[model samples]
Target: MQVTHAELVTSAVSPNQYPQDEIIEIALAGRSNVGKSSFINKMINRKGLARTSGQPGKTQTLNFYNINHQFRFVDVPGYGYARVAKTQRASWGKMIEKYLSQRENLQLVFLLMDFRHPPTELDIAMKEFVEELDIPYGIILTKSDKIKKSQWTRHLSLFKKDLDLPSVDALFPFSAESGEGSDLIWEIISDMIEA
Candidate 1:
């Protein structure tokens, strides 16, 4: 879908505070610095639309972006950052869990992962959460440019085999730098929005 106008609508701390609209929501889930923010910015063709940070755990809230003035891209705070206090991290965890579990408008989730590494523990946990909710989701392997082309097949194979997920079209190799797989992402997203 061509996003003619994407704007930051609100930053919500609770589901009750979310925009009171019926528009569908697509969530970006992943660990800190797994490129969730960068992925959103790239997909929407907006620089800094979803603030990218060199520092892990920089995004600490549920950021809501309205796209085409029609739907929403909900950026959940990245998990697995070690610098924050344990209690604070736990709070963030609860917040994300609540959002995912309670938000009725949430349609699809894009689980972001680094192409250079396997899915982390937090990634696994997020998958479990979505599965529990029976939520439709897709895997986005960001920073594909960091890895060689020949390694892509092997890495994806491992990801599917190890994750033991359902049929693997959900997994995609993406790169904000090269725009690899971005179109495919949009197609999947289009299908999701229509569904």
Candidate 2:
């Protein structure tokens, strides 16, 4: 979709604070430092729209960005940060679970993963959770420019084969630095909104 306008609407920690609109929401999910913020910034063609931090696990809230005022890009908090406390992590888990399982406006989830490696245990577990919840989602292979193309293909195949999610499209290689795959990602988002 042509991004005529994109702006941060709110940072929500609870469902009660989510935007009170039925607009379709496309959520971005990934581990800490997996380029989720970069992806959103690139997709919206707006620098600093999503905060990019050198420190992992800094995004501790559900960031909502209204796109064209038609739909929303929900940036879910990154998981599996080593420095985070166990109790904090558990709370994060519950928050994410509640949003994913019960959010009626959520239409699609873009699950980001590293391109150089196969899906990590956390990635696989998240995928399984989404499947069990019957949430529609797609895989996004972030930091593609960091890995060789051949290795990306191998890891992508491994992810699909191991997850038994062959019906879902192959990994979408993206690099916010290069703006690669930004258009394709936007196309997918538009399609979802239309559907």
Candidate 3:
């Protein structure tokens, strides 16, 4: 992933607002503070390309990023924030569900989860939703740098057990700050793009 050109193409709220292109789309989804923006920044080798915020639930729309014009990285609104209004949350749910279930160009989804803790109830629900939609997905365990390297396998295995993962290959540890797992993630994305 030699990202020479990476820029935000659009911030969309609905399918009509989405980019009208046939390019393959790989979506990034996770909890409100799962560090998705940081992962994007590390993947594109840019600082602050996708805004990172200390505040949770800052991303309120689906942000599309064109990566060297090869494929689009669609970042949907983060979920599971407590302070967000219920009505706003409902709208986000509809927005995300519509995109995930209906988008034709969407190829794969990368579900980010914080590695420091077990999956929350909302996390389980999102995973189940994606599964029910029958969409291909990968699990990215974020912030692995906080955990000891020796414990990663154990942690990942626990996640596998908790999520009832179809395959261990479908998931991996990630550390956006240290750029860990970026290559593997890129490899997965590239495979999907080429497929």
Candidate 4:
């Protein structure tokens, strides 16, 4: 997808606050600082449109980005940050669950995981939750540039084993710095939207 126009349509927290349209949506879910923002910027060829931050949990609301007015990319709040207050985390979890389980227009979710490490407890829980809800999802091994090329296979296997995934077909290796896997990701997204 050659994205010529992209805009942040809205930053919503509740269902009533979401954009009232029938456009399909794809969501990005991951732990804090797992490169969700970077993934979005890379996918659309925008540098700072999604606001990358070093701090974890910077995204507090559901950010809706209208991609060429075709579909919306929802950036959900990152989870598993210990610095966040329990009450705040609870609310964010509820917000995430509501959007994931109830949003009718949602088509797919890209589960972003740090390529350096295996899936964490929260990541496992998230995977299980989405599977339980029967939401179609794809795994993105983010920050691939941070690790050596030789270690890519090892890390991928670790994630696969930890997540109990039978094969590597569902995983995508993404690197925001090198633009790796951007085209393939876009291809998948384009096909999903078209379907």
| Top-TM-score structure, candidate number | 4
| Model 3 pairs in collision | none
Task: Report how far residue 51 has shifted in candidate 2, in Å.
Answer: 0.6
Cα lDDT tens digits, model 1, 1-195, are 788999889998887779998999999989898998888888888998888888999888899999987679999988899998999899999999898988889999988889899888778878888999999888999999999998888899888876777556779999999789999988887877777
**Order of candidate numbers by TM-score, starting with the best:** 4, 3, 1, 2
List, residue by residue over 106-130, the lDDT tens digit for candidate 3: 9888999999898888888888999
Give the TM-score (vs. native) of candidate 3.
0.97
Query: What C-alpha lDDT values do all the predictions have?
Result: 0.88, 0.87, 0.91, 0.93
Roughly what TM-score does model 4 have, to 2 decimal places? 0.98
Instruction: Arrange candidates, best lDDT first.
Output: 4, 3, 1, 2
Per-model TM against the reference: 0.96, 0.94, 0.97, 0.98
lDDT by residue (tens digit), candidate 2, 1-195: 668888999998998999997988988899998999899888878889888999999989999999898898899989999999999999999999999999999988889998777778899999899989888888898888887776766776777787677644746889988988888887887778777
lDDT of 4 by residue, 1-195 (tens): 789889999999999999998999999999998999999998888998999998898999999999998999999999999999999999999999999999999999999999888789999999999999998999999999999999888888888899989888788999999999888888888899878
- 72: Cα error in model 4, Å: 0.9
Q: State residue 53's C-alpha deviation in candidate 4, in Å.
A: 1.3
Greater TM-score among 2 and 4 belongs to 4
Question: Cα deviation of 71 in candidate 3 (Å)?
Answer: 0.5
Off by over 4 Å in 2: none
